[model samples]
Target: MSAVIALRAPLDEDLTAFVQSLRSLGVAHRVAEQGNEQVLWVPDEQVAAQVRELYARAPQGDPGLQPAHTSAQRARPGFLAQAKHSPLTLLVLALTLLVALLTWGGDNYDAGRWLSFVDFHIDGQYIYFGSFAQVIDSGQWWRLLTPMLLHFGLLHLAMNSLWYWELGRRIEARQGALMLLLLTLWFGLAANVAQYVYGGPALFGGLSGVLYGLLGHCWLFQWLAPNAAYRLPRGVLVSMLIWLLICMTGVFELLQFGAIANAAHVGGLIAGCLTGLLGGLLARRLQRR
Candidate 1:
């Protein structure tokens, strides 16, 4: 089972006290030692967030931290309630769905061009792509990040949205919506630019790159902190990396998987790992202090 680090106390005394309070509150947790600190791990992201909140408000193990009854612990929220906690994640999903509908899951070329990495127009029996100079002259810079909003088919949309929902909300809840947006844009831009260089002026759209980015971030972050919010299942990490390698082997195109964005996947993963390293170091520093 994947567990999250809910508390990282430098002193064993603090860990013991907090563990006692958490136990009284009936929160399922485990304690592990990481270098000079004692890290408390919990089952899920919501529980971790709640534990952090209560601990922040009353670090001395007050009644607030240890509620009146064990049942006072918040039950997991349904989809709507969870969406409220991560509005930006929900909003991005909504936008992607809207784009999918507008472009008929990427078959509508005219509509797709508006959001592709470069401007284009459909002519009789052929599509014309704009030159980089033309795109630059038009001052339509948003194109770089918008391709991620496009989806090529129902299955593609569903798969990407499901993964985004799974990975995006975790980070949003743990960090915040603003951080999530920044990271999304960072991943999206990197993915788009890499695909642009790889395939040049082609219509490629999907959340696959961003999905890899999130997976990469979570993989590295979990290694650094062992936080539940960032913990990815072991099989999941290996499976994705294996899939990426398979895609790079040109088997997908041969099998008519509609031209895999291999470069985008690699680029986003690299960006996410770097991002994860930076974020992990900062978080580790905060925990030590």
Candidate 2:
């Protein structure tokens, strides 16, 4: 038999710590559900005594003890909460779908040319030098802004969307959606322009560069404030860099695969890290005053 303990107030952070303590004490238990309320299951025999001891020392508002079953469904991250707090992340997702539609429709529909208004491309033999001239001659400076929203294929779109959704939400929450959007634009455009000059033509496209920027922004923000409310573990930073390397892995297998804008990836990753660090510094400097 098992007994449930319902905490009156939510236990979000100290949960793992408390659970570890229970294990060390030779107590058998399991977390039944998570939400505004958390249900802790303990053996029926030990429930009464533990309840008494916990009640004496527990913080105010804690229910201390209740009967709950293991069969109860656990709580999941609420979709509503996510939308209410980070609506921009949701908006970005919608725009991503629109981009996919434009990609497919543009090739098939006569209206596709309109979509190309923002797409960036390299020209001629010089993969590095050509893109800049094209950017300048094309007079589509807005391509720097719109390029972050474009994708090459279904697979490319899906992967980029997944990353945007996952990372964008947390970042938007911490820095606000407007700021993240600005950073993405700055890094994406700057990286695209830089790579065009360095990578030398061969035509390029995609949002991987801006994604790299977001990755760097998140990493530096966390690094600068290790003890801050949204601290990220060191592993996350390493993982971001590793992920960037994997994104560039396409360069090595270029012969087997179709043309890839790896230069944009490298450039974007570099730009993102630097921009993120700069943004963090700017924020801190402002906060100090």
Which candidate number would show the highest TM-score if scored against the true structure? 1
> Which parts of model 1 are misplaced by more than 4 Å?
1-76
lDDT of 2 by residue, 101-191 (tens): 8667224322332333233333564212233455569785775556566566788788877877767777787778897677767767766
Which lDDT values do the candidates have, in the order given?
A: 0.83, 0.59
TM-score of model 1 vs. true structure = 0.76
* Clash count of each predicted structure: 4, 12
**Residue 238 in model 1: shift from native, Å?**
1.0
lDDT of 1: 0.83
- On the 0 to 100 scale, the lDDT of residue 190 in model 2 is 67
